[model samples]
Target: MKRRDALKNIGAAIGYSAVIPTAFNLLQSCTSEKEKWTPLFFSVDEAIVIKNLVDLILPKTDKTPGALDVNVPQFIDLYAYNVYVEEKLEEYRLSIDSILKALPIPETGAIDLKYEDYDNLLKKYLKASKEEKQQYISDKNITYEALINLRNQSVWAYKTSKTIGKDVLAYDPIPAVQKGCISVEEATGGKAWSL
Candidate 1:
């Protein structure tokens, strides 16, 4: 056999070895287990607020799972605990605190509040126009920016979760050759690719 044929075979073997373990691991996600989850970073009240916030951002549907269902809050908490520096952690804490001040979280909890209230809040802050967000920055209120960051992070966490990545979106562990000839809608039924 020629050297070229041997090299191609070796590359294919390497690809297969790397993909198998990762694919298997992804198939076994935290969502499958019935473990009790607790917040890793947020305070009790803050955790309640964050939980509500994430739920509003991605509510469950008849067929699709929501952010909370896939553990987006847990992902956010763990990601922050692991990745953030002291100053960033402090900054985000302060940002969330500012938001908390605006909210009327009961002494007992916010369980009684309708879900739409949080959705409205998210729209007012994170979903606002660029100009409005900038105005918030100019006013020295970082809540808008903070909300944007949190929502972006939460959505990323949601998309990367095993359930969403595999079931909701397209999951191709070891990508083959690209087919630019087909439109995106036709390729994966308009579902975004998960990497």
Candidate 2:
């Protein structure tokens, strides 16, 4: 082979070898399990309840995807673990423990709550007969623990839902959609009309 041709082939082979592994890694990274993209901050037990809680907040619907579909549970865990300060995480832990204790259980072990269990418990306290809840508050009195638990869980779910809408969905600010898209003009009656 000509010296020039041999050198060219060597260069091509080197380039191909370098590119192949990177391409393969990228592909594998894309197809890897959901856990790969998700950074888990929660303990295995905490993750179980959090997963259930997120699913309850945003159940899979025919029209739109659910929380788990977008990995909201993982999002929450990541936020709580990485974003939240130690004080906040401590607060979250206490709140979660309270909720776990409030639910019907044989023992107060750090057991994971199934989706059904979390849903049933939340519905019982937040949805079922307002009168019953009020009465329980008036008679037995909802403990501070219960109240805190309810508050934390509700906040967590709400935050997770909002994040999904803003971050996961392809929502963008005005003028960000496309260049030279027809600008809607406001008509006299405050209705939108195309310019």
Candidate 3:
């Protein structure tokens, strides 16, 4: 074989060798389970409840997708497991358990609150006075603090997600001009700017 022809064949072989593994990897990733969101910190049941709660907290609207769509529950699970200290982790777990227990769970082990009902329940809590909140904590064993923590986490996860920050919210990939005095409405049409 000619030297040039031999080198050409070798180059083709090297190119194919490099491309084959990457192709297989891409195909494998595509074929893998799409719904692989197991929680590290939460039990399967707890994870399910968290998922339901987060979805309820940030339901899908005409403007943007809900927490479930943004994988906020998964993010919460990871954040609780990885970010929290031992004391905080225990507190989070107990709070989650308390909140789950407060909800009406059916024989199927799922919370029975409809989306609207859950939203109303959240609103009720949000609107409650300090005395009412204390009464609720004493009576129902579900603290407002726990609910607030959950809300904060959900909001953090939702706002920080790439989908929400980059797509749903106002994201400028390349900011050529920086105006400090611009109103939010003037800047990004009332949507919060991406960090």
Write model 2 residue lDDT over 1-195, tens digit each, in one string: 864344344435675344333322222233125655544456655555655655676677775667666555554554454334556567777766666566554354336345567767767666658687767667654434354354454444433353443544433444333445343332122232211
Identify the candidate with maximal lDDT. 1
* Model with the higher lDDT, candidate 2 or 3: 3
Best by TM-score: 1
Candidate lDDT (C-alpha), each: 0.71, 0.51, 0.68
Q: Which pairs clash (backbone N, Cα, C closer than 3 Å) in model 2?
A: none
What would the TM-scores of all predictions be? 0.75, 0.51, 0.70
- Per residue, candidate 3 scores C-alpha lDDT tens digits across 1-195 of 864344344435675344333322222222123278666889977877777778778899997888777777776776555445567668788888876676666677654546664565577776788888788777764546677788887887677666777898899989899789979999899987875
Q: Which regions of candidate 3 are displaced past 4 Å?
A: 1-34, 111-124, 129-131, 134-142
Candidate 3: worst-modelled 10 consecutive residues by lDDT: 25-34
What is the per-residue lDDT of model 1 for residues 32-79, given as tens digits with 9 covering 90 to 100?
342465667777677777888988878899989988888777667655
Cα distance off (Å), candidate 2, residue 175: 2.6
